[model samples]
Target: METLRHIVLFVHLIGFAVLFGAWAVQAFGGKREFTRLMSIGMSIAAVAGLVLAAPWGLPDGAEMNYAKIGTKLVILLVIGALLGIGTARQKRGEKIAPAVFWLVGILTATNAGIAAIW
Candidate 1:
């Protein structure tokens, strides 16, 4: 179980990289698929991480830093929204602003760092 936790943590970090890299690519004029995959992958990875970091032995809420976790959740949600918007626009062949991608990417990546460190 201890090893599993560490593995999950590592995967969580990889997920963050994938999420950030995909978003950054889109922000820098990459394809919409990158943004789509990032959003979906990040969301799934987060859920898996939470499951792996389960309530084993620790009292409820004791191991959690809710403030940071909440911030991370919010940022992730915002990224999800951006992904949705990008999808809708892409369906119509519209070009989304790079600034939007940059904002979402930077914010989400920062949130991931905060969750890991803070």
Candidate 2:
């Protein structure tokens, strides 16, 4: 069970990397468009993160950090919303606001920081 948890954790990190990596590339490349890779990465991260939030593999009497988990979950949802809104706007022939595009990257990094620091 512990090994399984580790595996899931690895996948969760991979997902984070994918999402952030895609965002970084686009941001640095001067493109504001959303890609399928970003959505794929977010989906992977969200699913793996949800799995990690469970208590299945925890040691006896050890509890999960609900507050941290909740915070990260909310951030993930916000990122998802941003992605959806930005993609929709792109599809509608409207330019995605720079703030919206930048927020996605900022939030993604913030989520990773929280996971690491807290």
Could you tell me every candidate's TM-score relative to the true structure? Answer: 0.77, 0.96
What TM-score does candidate 1 reach? 0.77
Q: Please give the RMSD to the true structure for each candidate, in Å.
A: 3.1, 0.9
Task: List, residue by residue over 1-118, the lDDT tens digit for candidate 1.
Answer: 5677677777877777788777767666666344556876787667866765465545445675666666777777787787778677767888766666567777777877777688
Worst 10 residues of 1 by lDDT: 52-61
Instruction: State each candidate's clash count.
Output: 0, 0
lDDT of 2 by residue, 41-64 (tens): 999999999999988998788889
Candidate 2 clashing pairs, residues 3+ apart or interchain: none
Give each model's whole-structure lDDT.
Answer: 0.70, 0.95
lDDT of 1 at 82: 78
Candidate 1: deviation at residue 67, Å? 1.5
Q: Which regions of candidate 2 fall more than 4 Å away from where they truly are?
A: none
Cα deviation in Å at residue 9, candidate 2? 0.4
Give the Cα error of residue 18 in candidate 1, in Å.
1.1
